[model samples]
Structures are given as structure tokens and as C-alpha cells.
Target: MHRSVTAGAAAAALLALSACSSSGSSGSSGSSSPAASASASSAVTGTVTVFAAASLKNTFTQIGKMFEDAHPGTKVVFNFGGSDTLAASIVNGAPADVFASASLATMRTVTDKGDAAGTPTVFVGNGLEIAVQPGNPLHITELQGLANPSVKVVLCAKTVPCGAAAQTALAAGNVTVTPVSYEQDVTATLTEVGLGEADAGLVYQTDVKGAAGKVDGVNFPEAACAINKYPIVTLAHPSR
Candidate 1:
């Protein structure tokens, strides 16, 4: 659904501050005091809409809630979907304030259009895994296992980051899979397996963790070949 990221340190504090202002200048923070907290809270008091990757749904939801709590009267709304789709939406004037993409290439779609407030920074990294039913009913093991003709695998569309990563991992392992279906996003791919619609699907580790009991994750060595770095940036729009 999305594409690239760089050093992780760049976005350490972006989560809390990106939605606060339009300034590109940096400032040092003082000791956390009541006055400082009050000043931060009063800096911004409107809704900040974030368009993010579906894989970020769980993590971003938590962050959004914390943001809302830290600044009373301020709201943080999120639109989570495949990174590629989100990027396309933003480029077409989706009216979002922030964009946290799972892929660097996906973020480039927006940045290249001059739609970003600043450089997009890597906030985190995610790797792929095989999501299957609660137990190993078919005894599927590694990337090679997905090659079985009867596996009934589901995959994300190659245009999306997760799907692209899955393809990389499969290539690294020299394994081939004929998916039963191609989903638009990783969430949809994982849901297919979670609902027992497919035997397995390649998805981000975070996705499996998010689905928990609904699906079980199978780690494979090839996943290291396609780890995706997540990037966060404030979109250049009328809101800021």
C-alpha cells in the first residue's frame, strides 16, 4: 500500500508535535512543568486529520487518543487505509493535515507533488509474516509452504507496500504463490485468513499482532529481506 523511510530518530517527537503547527523551525523543550503543559495545550485547538496506512490502525489509534487527552478541546481524526491509496487521495486533495505512510515510495507520491510540510521521516519499521488460522492445521511452515497448490493464499495488490514486500520476500526465498485473491490492503489480506476465507496471507507483523486470536503468525527467514520503514509527515494543506 505504501513505499520508503530513512533514519528513525527524525520522527521521535513528531507524533505529538506534527499536528500542532505549520512552522518548520525547531525548538528545544524545557522541563515538563504545568505552565509548559498549559502552553502546549493552548497552541492548537482544532481537529487534525491524519491519513495513515492500515497497518498503523492499532498503533495510531492509541496515539490519537493520547493526543486528544493531552490537548483538551483538540481532536485528532485518522483515515487508515493502504498507503498507496492514501497517498493518491492526498495528492488528489483529500484534506488531511498529517500523513503517516508505511512505505517511502508511497510518501513520495505526495511529497513529489509538493504536498508535504517538510521532509517525511522514518518513524518505525515493519516486517512481513505469514498469517494463518489459529493452529497449523495444514502444517504450513515457511515461504516455501505457500507454494503448495492447495494452500489457498491471499495477497495484497502489488501496488501496495505490504504486497510489494511479500513479493520481495517470496523472491528472496525463490518461492512462487498463486493467490486466491489480491486484496487492496494488508488489513483486507489478513482478514481473509482470519475469517478462514483463505489458508494464509502475507501481512505485516504488526497486523498479526493487532488481529491476535483471530490469526496466528508464522515467522520466516525471508521476511528480513523485505522490512518496510514507516514515515510520518505533516501535509502541506490549508489546515496548517
Candidate 2:
């Protein structure tokens, strides 16, 4: 996974999460001196509202809890949904301290509208997976398998990161698929397959992993062609 936090947006980034350590943290002298660390830690307070993509729900929730435990007076609130929807919300004057998107393209939407502060950092790289029922009743193996008319395939809408990646992977595989329904986010698509509402759904590997027991993941080679780079940024206006 590709991960990086922008130094310029360090404060807001830290507000969103402080449980993680930098790669150099193992060294004697890290980026920040002990004195600076103490001072910064003391100053971190209040609620920091973060707009994040749905795919980050599991990991981000764990990190948010860790951050709150580290800082007594601080709270990290998250609004998880489609990256495009979150970007649109930020650009439309939503009150958010940070924006964590599932795709660079979606993050660009916020940055282009001047809703982001400093520069956006690439936080992770995600690939696609086909989420199927635990027993694999359909016996699906690849992307093209979803092309069968009898398969109830669910896909993310073209506007969302997962959906866009699915489209790219499908095109790369030269497979034509008409999904039974288009969901708004990867989590939603995965939910459809997990609940047995759909035969299979195209979603992020992370989503499938998060729903491990409930759904089985089928990895396809074409996924490499549509890997999504997640981006995070501190919003310009953060309402407490």
C-alpha cells in the first residue's frame, strides 16, 4: 500500500489520526524533537470532522479511536461515503477538517475548487476484487464471468472511485458487463453481495477483506490496470 502524509497539512492530518508513527520513528531523533512533540500533543484539542471514502471505514475508525484515546479532549468524527460524493460535499461548503478520498481524481475535485488546504497526500493504493457469496455458488472466477446475463452483478456508479476503477478494469479485460445495479460506493456494492442481494459485486480488496467471513474475494489480473491511489488533504474551512 502507498501511504504518505503531507508535512504542510500535518496538524490537520494529525487531528484526523495520531496513532500511526512515521517510518523514522524508530530512530533516536525523529522528525520532531521530544519538546516539540509534547507541545504539539498538548495543543491538539476539540473535534476534527473528516470526510472519508467508505472503503476506509474499517481502518479509519480504528485509527480515529486510537487518536481520541491519545488526546483526551480531541474527537475525530468521520463521514464515510463515495469519494466523489464526499468531494462534492467539501466543494459545496461542508464543514470538514480533513478529506480522505479513495481516488486521486475525486480529491482533485475538491482541490480544484480550492476546498483543500496545503497539498493532498497520497495515502494508499487499492485494487479491485469480485465479492461473491461465502460458498461461491455461482462459481465465478474472473471479471468476464460477470458478463453472464444470469449473474446478478452489482457495480459502483461511474462517478465513484470503485466504479470508475471497475470500468477501467473491464475495458482493459475487454469484457462487456451490464450490472444489475450501480451502487454509490464500494461498501454498498460489497453489501449487496454479502447480503445475497446480488450474485457478485465489483469492489475494493479492502472492502472484501473487511467483510471476509460474509463474502469471498476473487482477484483478477486486470485489477492491476485499475489500481486507485487514495489521497487525503486538510480542508480549508473546518467548523468545530
Candidate 3:
């Protein structure tokens, strides 16, 4: 009778231990399922591409860095060039999230094609400047100085924003300058001046600001009459 009683207690103890182990395993499995689901849901990280005007390269780069710091999981990619070219590329279905142009004319090209998300906002304004090599070796003093037959001048192509602004200023002053080269973008024009390939080049004041010690900026009165405003827009159907 004592042996039977001891056997019955041992069987009951074994059943309790098995039940406890099954319950603990079930609880752990249930907890790990939610963790796996959360990880799957939170895995979203990629790059946002932006096509901006050449003049905006420096400022936008700084802004991009700040944006990346604010959004740790995302990256910012930039394609900087002439506003007209960027607008044309967006119209042709280039993958870009943001479009920033140096002139309204260029923005219109994108908006007219119904590529822009909304009306663009003017974020900044820039004026034209005559950029010369460090030390102004050519002694260019004013806008009319560019007309000097001996001066080698570089200008932006008329389709570009800087070129349009330069045209307005020159027309306002009634000064005609025959440029040695008409660059496709303001950066190219500035590059020519920085390299001393051209005696002077018309570029945005901001470009000169970037060159800092590499070039000397001469502010002429005509720049006030032809200041260009920069506008930025997000595409309606941006490709990720």
C-alpha cells in the first residue's frame, strides 16, 4: 500500500513538470513572433535623389548634410547642373525627388509638363558678379570692361539662368561683350575664370562665395537690376 501511494505521487509530480516546460516554451515563442514582425516592418532605408542648379551645389550640399543628420536612416543624393538641363531631364523621366532651379523660366519647363508636385517656393536670391582670377590680373573694373577687345570673356549659354540674367544686365547697361566661350552652365563659366582660362566670367555671387580665395568677385551696378531668384519644387511622381 505504501509503494502504490509513493508511485502515484511520483507520476503527478512528473505531469506538473511537463506542463510547466510546455507553458514556458509557448510563452517564449509568442514573444519572439512579435519581435520578428517588428523587424520586418521597420526595414525601410534608401536614398532621395535631388537635381539642383549648379550654383546651388555648395549651399544644397550643406543642407543635404543637415537633412541626413535629421533623418538617420536615409541618404541624400544630388545631381547638380544647369537648371534648364535638369528641368529637361525631369521631363524626360529622370528619377528625382526634388528639383531646384536658379530661375523661374527653368521651373516653368518642369511645371508645364505637370512634373512638379505643387507651386514651387522661392528659397533664395542670387545676383551676377564678374569673377576674375585672384588679384584681378586683367584689371577688369566694370561691366563695360568686358567689352574691351583684349579681354577674354566667358559667358553662360543664353538658355541657362546665369546667361539670361547676364543678358538682361548687359541690355540694361547697353554694353556688348563678345565672349570667347559660352558655357552651358554657370559653374563652367566660373571654372574658366578660376583656371585663368578667361580674363573674366559672369557668374552668380554665390559661386564667387564658394571660390573664396580662388577668385575675386566684382559687383557691378547691373547685377541689382537682374537678380535671379532660386525656386525649389518636389516632383508629383518622384521615383524612389
Candidate 1 lDDT over 89-168, as tens digits, reads 99998777778888889999999999987788665678888999998798888889999999999999999999999999
Candidate numbers, best lDDT first, in rank order: 2, 1, 3
Give residue 87's error in model 2 in angstroms: 1.0
lDDT of each: 0.77, 0.77, 0.74
Q: For candidate 3, lDDT tens digit of each residue in 1-240? A: 112122222122112222222232211211124543343234234566678899878766766665556445645678899999999999998877678788889999999999987667665677888999898987888999989989999999999999999999999889999999999999999999888899899998878988878899988998888888776766765544
Candidate 2 regions exceeding 4 Å error are: 1-42
Please give the lDDT score for candidate 2.
Answer: 0.77
Q: TM-score of every model? A: 0.84, 0.86, 0.80
lDDT of 1 at 181: 99
List runs of model 3 lying over 4 Å from the truth: 1-45
lDDT measured at residue 91 in model 2 versus the true structure, 0 to 100: 86
TM-score of 1: 0.84
- Cα shift from native, residue 93, model 3 (Å): 0.9
Order of models, best TM-score first: 2, 1, 3
Shift of residue 149 alpha carbon in model 3, Å: 0.8
The candidate 3 region of ten consecutive residues with least summed lDDT is 22-31
